[model samples]
Target: MTDTPIFQPGDALASARRTLLTEAQAIETLAARLDDAFAEAVRLLLACRGRVVVSGLGKTGHIGRKIAATLASTGTPAFFLHAAEAVHGDLGMLTAQDVLIALSHSGASQELLTVLPAVRRLGAKVIAITGNPQSELAQLADIHLNGAVDQEACPLNLAPTASTTAALALGDALAVACLEARGFGPEDFARSHPGGALGRRLLTHVRDVMRQGGAVPRVPLSATLFQALEEMSAKGMGMTVIVDDANRPAGIFTDGDLRRLIERRGDLRGLLAAEGMSRNPRTIAAEALAVDAAAQMDEQRLSQMLVVGKQGELIGALHMHDLMAAKVV
Candidate 1:
């Protein structure tokens, strides 16, 4: 029988770290290799009227999915279509207006090559990303991007380690370039990813989540403290807006105010709303983005903010709870 190899803890850990560094280096090399072809690919995708369809097999499929997601989220409309599935009628997803980016390290994935004729017949331009420029797929493509790696991180040199990572990084580069070329902004990204964290940060404006007029509890300066409590109870907003004679927001009275007033055994009926309400309450603009409001609230340690117009009129009110539900917090 063959002898079993001895394991050294330090040696094994060091080897793994070296492999990770090698993968990182592969990505950097791919970045340096980018040329006019990368720009041409971006232009082809932006000119597409339908979508960018990414196809791959094996580990390449995993990277393809991520690349498609990044492209879609960043403004380039794209989706992943398994090479095997394309032969099984999924090819219907592609159209003349679409562009196809096929991924394969060897550039000889059987499923991919089988659909090349149909892909061309549909008038869809194919961009091949592979390690071999002389491969059949590369020769068939309208454009080819070289994603070669000198060696893999795997000691056996059999696993797709450094090569797959390089491909993924290259895909990200393409996505970002296309995003910039399209002038896609945060608002566009938000629209594409409405359920994601980025959407909450960019699309959730103050007007969408803020409590509006009539729903906001408020009382005149001449009203008694007992009257403010009744208003707060009825509105269920946990606070009452204090407005000036011109209906401008003066300050606010909250649950904390109630606690302080209660601690002093203050006269609930005798005190006026102007006396009990805070005069320098935190406020935000009705047009302010939710992200900015969240930052302001965190910096000031305030639980809620009064939304006002340019004239300081009480337009709406926002609570920390609204931000929490919107996932902006």
Candidate 2:
């Protein structure tokens, strides 16, 4: 008997290409179908007085969790609840003022169907995202947004491929739409992602991470190099800003300069800050974001930078260590 042949290289490549094209087509179909139902769903969610309760099962549950996270991070308060878990007592998390968004490709997820009635009975608004608008979950919802795809990207047409992607994209659209309607800003996004780099960039200002006022390692130009070194040691910032009599930043001295001076056998006690410091050192505005200051430090190849006010007066200092501690870089 002849053995069934395995897929050849050309066949495998063709199959992958077909799958990608199929999924892309499915996404296009889903996008074109978006309309007023999408708007209504956004309105219902916005009108909600409490958190959005997202529920689904199987692959839909994974999609639901992402949708909930997107909603939460984009200004909407939301959380995911497994429908099966909800029926097993997690339903207590839902409240009368909450809005329920149920995800099911068939609009007939048995677990969601089982607990959805309870969600509605509790006076929560129910919004369903499913491929079949005529399916039971859609019929039960107060608002229904079609997440229909033309077909599955799976060759067997069984696995949740194109359908799942379509649903996930639709949910993202809803999140962004609601986010725009609420005028959600970077600060609001940062609040939801406080532990991430984007959050640090948006929330960390110079004031939050700078060595301020007396804590800044600063000295007048007339101060001896020994005094500047002492100030740098006391502040533990590895550098010192040299200011003029008017308190304007005139120059900077770092550990590197001190090393160079020592190598040249220069007397640390006899040299003044003006004679030893690097004139017109790279500086940042006091109001600059910590991330911007970090970039400036990187570009200048410096471990520390001076923070100056509008009139170029030294207000504080930023060190690479401070940026690292604040996660600004």
Candidate 3:
């Protein structure tokens, strides 16, 4: 008989669904298997004084690199090393203070086994992540994280699928746990990711980018439209805040308001600031996050807002331009 199989509708779809279920079920099993060994690995990682050096071969190596990156970005210092390259002098990077994480799906990767002894000799403890907890790699490790899965998504069951997924999930769990224990917060994450939108939202506070001091446009409620217009022009923020006797904001007269007044009154040059201004304008705190300010402005369909102090006194002014300049928009 010929080896070629017959084609059919939905066959590929059926296979894909089966594969996903297999891999997802594998992770569930791994979660159930989590025991003291997992805790021990976490403790060792937390106690490590130096970096986490991850080493693996082949497909395991790809997973190892991703794990190392996640750990590093989340506050756990980590870097990836190839087991094949370690024997060639890369092992020198490991020291007693560091923790060596070895990933081997079969628990019998020769390249990894070849360098384990050398790393151990350097005083570094080993944490093995493998599918076979009873294998030689596991036996040699100071701690083992069981990454066992029943079978791979490959129809032939020869390729690494469920195993690699389990390994990656376990790695993420470890990184997040360490992150929480260390009190790593958004501000710290922003420091590491200074170019991302999330970084701008967290690191760029309202006060850092607000127009303050004399740069803020202000006019007494008793000021005429002509006087308010001059204040707005001088401040260059396109708006002027009208303050009450207590120095709290009572209203705002924007260039938009001036245009509307000209259209309706036909003689705004003689009107008082209070008669032409929008009353009880939206306001934000000077210490609030720039992200919150952006959200507030977007929600209100506003282009400019007044920044206030804790006691509701106007301290600064911000426009959509300011948020854009700060890269928070």
Candidate 4:
């Protein structure tokens, strides 16, 4: 049976700290080593007519996958191709207009080396990221990015720890530079991530969530307070909009208003909706973003908002509960 190492909390903590420090230092060193070659690499990627293909093996391959995803999400067309897969038949995925980013910390991965000549013959440019500047991969590449680290963070100084961290940081720097150069913004990002929260906030419109047609709680301005209360109860929005003959919103009456009116006057006698309602209520365009509507509600401390059309006519109603149900809150 193989003996397991004894568990020592102190030693484990020390090792963890050392690993973090080593990886952090590796990234710092990579940043300091950036030169005109990095700019040229970014230019090459930007000028490419086709997609960016990233390839690597083992631990570096994992890093390459993440880099490709970052590039793709940030408005650069990119994908990852495993080095071993490329040597087999996946090289066909490459086109003359494409740019290849090959990762090999040793700068001598056999799989990458085997695919390099064919990639070159296909008329695609190559960008190599390796720890050794004098390595054959670096020499063969059209542009070389130095990802060299002082040492690995492993206790034995053998495993790829600090080196992988450096490579990832360098890849991230390249992606961010391309993103900024392309003027990629939150809207563009949201388009690519439609299933995420930011996409919901940006893409969902007030009309998409606001209650429309007969669902909206509304009444004529000349209606009695009891009639307005009936409309609010039927719509279940805790509020009712009072509109004029033109269907333009004249005022709003809420449960809070009803409570205050009863507390002040204590009379259930002939009160018009106009006399009981609050005038000049807040209204939003149906085309406005739901997140914007949410923001307005928060700023005004409102539980409900009226939706209006271009001609100041009532079209729908929006409530805080609707925003909550849509997850736009």
Candidate 5:
């Protein structure tokens, strides 16, 4: 076994800083080197009717996988195909309408070079990302993106460090440019990521997390304060909706109103729900988003909101707790 040298804390930190600075500079240099070729590549990808197929080997393969994911999530149809695997039979995944993005630092990866003729014969256009502009892969490509970097961050300057960073940054720029050019909005993004937070906020409606029918606390306006309290206690919503004979919400009575009533009247035996209730309670449509409801509640300093229909009749109720339970808040 070889003896290892112990690194001091400062030595480790300094090394990390240098690595970051080197990678950052590599991306900066790549940005400065961008030309009409970058725009042409973007146009090629944007015009593709079929999927984008990214192919690479070694560390470049890992970056290719991430690039494919970013492209897919940002509205571009894309997937990764291992260059070595392509020769083994996976090349069948390629189609005439597809666009192939080939990655190689030296631009001479044997597996990629071997599959190039087959890809061309299949009629798919090629975009090569390489450090060597004069290499065979770059020369054969329909559009070549120069991803050259000054040096690697490796101590020996041999490991794939800064080169990979530059390549990944270039991939991200392509994905984002395609996304913007397509006019992809948040709603479009949310559709692609239904399990994410933004998806829940945009897709989940109030009816999905509201208390309906018997579960909602409600009472007639003619009911005594005692009856409203009974309904509130049974439903556990901290408040009760006071509706008229047609079942339209006339007012709302909460715990705060009860306390205020007791302080003012001193005797609540004959007080009716209508007299104690707060008039013109805030209402939200059952079809609205739960996040929008939460925003309305926050704006009004309310813990609960009445859900009404097109005819302004009470249909359901929503509490802040309901939104929390649904993970929409």
Candidate 6:
């Protein structure tokens, strides 16, 4: 267990609020400074045939790497290269088809200055993100993005706090603009992130994860309790859909229904499924997203649901465990 701190909660809370407000104001300032240059940078990136190459130094380099990643994941092909290494023959990565986004808060990093001319000569356009608009980098680049901040969130105003935030926000703005301009949709995002749970949520459908045909555990409405129990045990999904003569679901029988019937009558030897099953059980469509099915299960506090078609015919069954195995949850 952790011990209590020396400072009072009220004082600490006040300081935290001040820090957040400071960064908010800094972002507001950057937003106001955004101009036609921002749009021009967007246009340059959009027209580029090759990849986007991002470079920076130290903390600004960290921000650049993240910016590059965001851009790539959002359908803009991009990668990061260290500014210091660019001068040491790393410049071979550049070509006329590529675009370079150089990040330097001061716009005076020696390493970036050393390679800017070479990158330009190689025919790759440069977009400089710098706080000092008059600095060499901003002056030399084809387009200058004004990432200036009023002050750092630090009390000493020496660390790269608010400045980095402004740069990151601006980078995010550019990536989103590019994403929208290209009409990149969720399906495209899923393709980019296929290994994560988010990918399963966006890419998977109920039909893909549902148990269909003979795999679906179901019994007729007239099936006896013993018969329904046998089907549920055989399927091992802990529930069975009770269907009518036309193969449409009229009700459902689950382990919970068995427990309730046992408590109410203390015996179910001669009971039929229609006598004990819950009528009008909620259902989901087979065409729905698997994540939507998970949401419905959680919302209804159920472990399984009958999957049906638009015509109210039983097509399959979806279980909570299926969603778990598919990583939709």
Number of the top lDDT candidate: 5
lDDT of 2 by residue, 91-182 (tens): 99999999999999999888899988898899999999998989999999999988888779887789999998888888899899999999
Q: Rate the local accuracy (lDDT) of all candidates.
A: 0.90, 0.88, 0.91, 0.94, 0.96, 0.93
How many times do residue backbones clash in model 2? Answer: 0
Weakest lDDT window of 10 consecutive positions for candidate 5: 1-10
Task: List, residue by residue over 171-281, the lDDT tens digit for candidate 5.
Answer: 999999999999999999999989999999998999999999999999997899899999999999999999999899999999999988889889999789788899999
Alpha-carbon lDDT of model 2: 0.88
List RMSD in Å for every model shown: 3.3, 4.0, 3.7, 1.3, 1.3, 4.9
TM-score of each: 0.85, 0.81, 0.83, 0.97, 0.97, 0.78
Kindly indicate the candidate among 2 and 5 with the higher lDDT.
5
Error of 4 at 146 (Å): 0.7
Candidate number with the higher TM-score (1 or 2):
1
Better of 3 and 4 by TM-score: 4
Decreasing lDDT order of the candidates: 5, 4, 6, 3, 1, 2
Which ranges of candidate 3 are over 4 A from the true structure?
A: 1-9, 212-224, 230-237, 242-251, 259-266, 271-275, 278-285, 298-301, 308-315, 324-329
TM-score of 1: 0.85
lDDT of 4 at 192: 88
For model 4, the superposed segments whose C-alpha errors exceed 4 Å read none
The deviation in Å at residue 245 for candidate 6 is: 8.6
Error of 5 at 270 (Å): 3.0
Error (Å) of candidate 3 at residue 22 is 1.4
